[model samples]
Target: MKTLLMITGAALALAANPATAQDRSNDRAGDIQFKVLGTAVLPDGEIEQVNVDIVGLPANTQTAASDNYVPTIAVEYFVTHNFSVETIAGITQHDVDAVSGLPGAELVSDAQLIPATVTAKLHFDLGDSIKPYVGAGPTYFLWVSDKPGAATIPLGVTDTDLSDEFGVALQAGVDVALGDDGFGLTLDAKRYFIGTTARWFAGDVLAIETEHNIDPWVLSAGVSYRF
Candidate 1:
């Protein structure tokens, strides 16, 4: 959060500079912008429903997934001065641990995720150098791989799987142009509404099945270039 604040402050300061306002326009249609960013993926991994409990999990069992930080790349194409389409690429890893009934017990380990997303954005014209945008789109959360946690291994758990699901995302962000060379800074935030089903098997027998809410907030800050 501190990093996001610092980047946002820097972008705002640059946008307010009179020098940047006169440094050539950043309003070119049919242009493309690329960004390299540091991103934080914060997810809520609470159990929404328990479908099967052959292993006899305790009542009031709850779980949470760990947060992850990773580098990401974003590509955007301008359809007009105030409208664009954007997409991002990145992979993140997480762990799900029991936080309530069985505190500190790991239930899922090394879960790799790829969030494939695309958004159509509407940029509001605030000034020549400063642009703020709002966007919405669909996203697919793909699970690459996952393993049953150590705690579950003793329960004769042989495998674990997380279902790939489709969801929607809402985004808001600001971009500040630096100069005529098409370099700038950007800060963005996206909220995702998603869910997944988790299954655990022991020798081909379904030991557990659970429905989880995996909604996440993705935050990013980075430098951007337009061409």
Candidate 2:
């Protein structure tokens, strides 16, 4: 009879603890965070092709070399503690010069492009300080300017029609947390695979077609805040 009475008293005591009950409720609130990042383009790529077909210039005498160094900004939102969505925007500038081996002919041209992208990311925590992640998505390119000189061909033989481009991205990064106050420092790397079609024209005359594949590397460091 005494054993039964003691068991009843212990059960009543366990049922009266309010702290344990409140902890379960707080666990369902989830974790949401925001981050801002800055990135720079790393020099990475080989010249694929350069085609020029204009009057008064040798058809096979034109070529181009790849350019690097681009800057970008990104804003990210965490849907949960381990998942996030981000949007990135940036601009890139390039300069190409044509050399004619046929005596004295020199030509130089410059171009620029701005691209905006949206991506989804997944995060993994390694402990209290380190978090590594990966991301992928799509992008749209806006052709800003295309300026060329007349020494290689003619003054009016400039191509400025580079249509919109489409591509995908891949990324990986690590975050180092600052204390327990939802603050951290982050370092990351990303690759974007983008391609576009370029059309050359002499006033109203269609000259040549060139396909451009731009694959650029990005390295970044930033800070993050969580709630």
- Give the candidate number with the greatest TM-score: 1
Clashing pairs in 2: none
TM-score of candidate 2 relative to the true fold: 0.68
Models 1 onward score TM values of 0.88, 0.68
Best by lDDT: 1
Give a tens-digit lDDT track for model 2, residues 1-227: 24423433443354345432224433313465555666666433222455654554454444442455544556677665555787866677655444333323323345667767787776654565676666677877676886643453555665556667788776667778899888888887767787666556777776655565556766777787766
lDDT against true structure, model 1? 0.89
lDDT of 1 by residue, 133-208 (tens): 7777999999999999999999999999999999988887989999878899999999888999999999899999
Model 2: C-alpha RMSD to truth?
14.6
Name the 10 consecutive residues with the lowest summed lDDT in model 2.
19-28
